[model samples]
Target: MLDTVCGGGGVREAWGWWGRTLGGPVTGPDGAAWLRVAHSPVEKAGGKLWTGPEDAERLVPEPVPRPRLRLVRQWTDGGDAYKAELYDRVAGGTLASGPVLTDAPSLPVAWWSGLRAALGLLSAVRTERTAVRQAYLDRAMPKYLGFLDGGGPVPTTAPAWSTAHGDLHRANLVGPELGILDWEGWGSAPAGYDAALLHVYSLAVPETARRVRAELAAVLDSDAGRFAELVVVTELLQSAERGDNLALVPALRRRAGEVWRAFDGR
Candidate 1:
């Protein structure tokens, strides 16, 4: 399939890796491109996650430090559906080795400056598409926040709404170059949602987490940003219930309490 996508250019077999989705680097006549393919049940392949890259290409503006989508192909086999997306390859590696930051990364001053600018621009874009739905927030916040001490009853009302990358983790952040990847979930979310999500993912490394809060303070320190933190923490706690990021559960709970205290002070 990749050979067909690249018109016979070879995919780098030694560079391939997989997680929730599978992808690898490939060489085409024009240049090198990253080929990502996602598979889902046929009935489940019609929504946001399935069409995210194409939407990001059409909706997200340039100079945002993200790989541009070039081509997309979709096919169905029996009960399963597969979608392939080809994007311009980013040069530097991700900020962290994976979704969760396990160690502090030494990023340049320019990288932090670029990230702040990129997120500011992205948040200002007007879009009907939603990265974090109000309905999901309403449902998840009450249920997941209940898992934390004194987490229940934190209102889910967002002070403002803005475009977000949705999944702004270390793995999705390309560093030394400052490109954000995995646009599979970019759309309208609570203002400051991206910054809050990044801060949560960085919690495994205390210094990195502090850096995220400090670097993105314009958003992370706002009323909307504080609300966004609760939303992110709730989502992660829910994921933890499924045995994902279990290590971060304690930290997440502690943060929830701190945020709750801030709200109490208001």
Candidate 2:
């Protein structure tokens, strides 16, 4: 089916696209492009139209430095599945660099600079839901503040929210030029939400985690940022309980304990 979309460009490389979508860098007959396929009746199809590259290309103004999504076209199959052709391939590929399980990427300073620039630029985006609810905070506050689950000190109220990338992990980012992808959840979240999420994802790699925290200190090292980090840590703990990445449990627990200590000190 992808062959028909690109009119036949041999697939150069492919990667799992957020569970429901498929297609990677394709050498199209016309040129290079990416193919994204999804079945209808699934989760949100055409989600990228609003949150992915399209939204960035349309909404984010120039000097913002986001990858432009040139939508070639799209068609729906009889089964309600759809496919779209797009261009704007990243040279450095994903920030994950290689196999997700073993990758320990060493990003350049330029990467951090570009990322900060992009994040600041994205703040201009507005959404209908001004105040986004964070579920992680609900579970984390009790455990960290030592409440009903145990008993210690009460946590402060959640800090203010801001427009942010809902998911910002190494896999969802591209480097060299520093482009962010996987915009399925772009909206108004807590100010440091994206940075916190990325930091949590990197907990297994101490150096990388340290770099992430340092680069995002403006967000991760603040009262609001601490609150955000707790939320992400709780989410990771929940994932561990669900039998997802059981190996992540120890690191997550350690981080959670540290956050609790910090909260107690304050």
Candidate 3:
């Protein structure tokens, strides 16, 4: 069992339970110590949570000199927020990537690697007993149909589907370790979902964004043009699912046209 070393005003009760479970020394981010027991991660249906199995399989943990740690507690009866052990605090950091993007020339390489990783996840899902492909198509097709009817360009036939990180972005990706967190929406999804998500988020940084798109296109080869359209459509669908925030809808629509035209060689 693990004890998260972080706590605040309302977290005391949760921490108490955590301490009781771990029955061992537990530290908080503030350096407060306690005792607790830990339990193995489990899956509960209809619960919008991503835990051990998904993370263990999808992510390749970067080697660290010391053990990577996290708070061993889940959202309990209290509220939605998690009470977790926090370790290896990096200082002097800001959440915003700023207007200027990092000179990550290897972003293409990372994109290629990520695509392969995404494909690997898809292969694993295919091996599972459940008909995962149909499940995704069921969800994906409706969105595509709606967008297409609304004059948005999108691929009707199935592209590729796989387990996706759903919200892959640079902020969620930590350096050196390449750790991805916030797995709330992790699940089986389309091949280009994560890559598209990352590309959208990286757009603020022109060079990084270009590198991501180019790399993805390069990897897909002749299919790159069609895949690029799929990427834009996926972003629009995801945005609509989150909330019908109309702010970026026009931009996405414009991009969809651009990608479709490019793919059709119009």
lDDT of candidate 1 at residue 149, scale 0 to 100: 52
Flag the better candidate by TM-score, 1 or 3. Answer: 1
What candidate 3 gets wrong by more than 4 Å, as runs, is 1-71, 78-154, 204-206, 220-247, 262-266
Best by lDDT: 1
Each candidate's number of clashing pairs is 0, 0, 16
Reference-based lDDT, residue 69, model 1: 87
* TM-score against truth, every candidate: 0.91, 0.81, 0.54
Clashing pairs in 1: none
Q: What is the lDDT of residue 22 in candidate 3?
A: 25
Q: Model 2, 29-145: lDDT tens per residue?
A: 456656665444424455543245455555665665544566645455554646464765666677774212344688889989777777777766776433246564565656643
RMSD of each: 2.5, 3.6, 8.2
Model 2 error, position 106 (Å) = 1.7
Cα RMSD for predicted model 1: 2.5
Q: How does model 2 fare in lDDT?
A: 0.65
- CA lDDT scores, all candidates in order: 0.83, 0.65, 0.45
In candidate 1, stretches whose alpha carbon ends up further than 4 angstroms from where it belongs are 1-20, 147-152
* Candidate that beats the other on lDDT, 2 or 3, i.e. the better one: 2
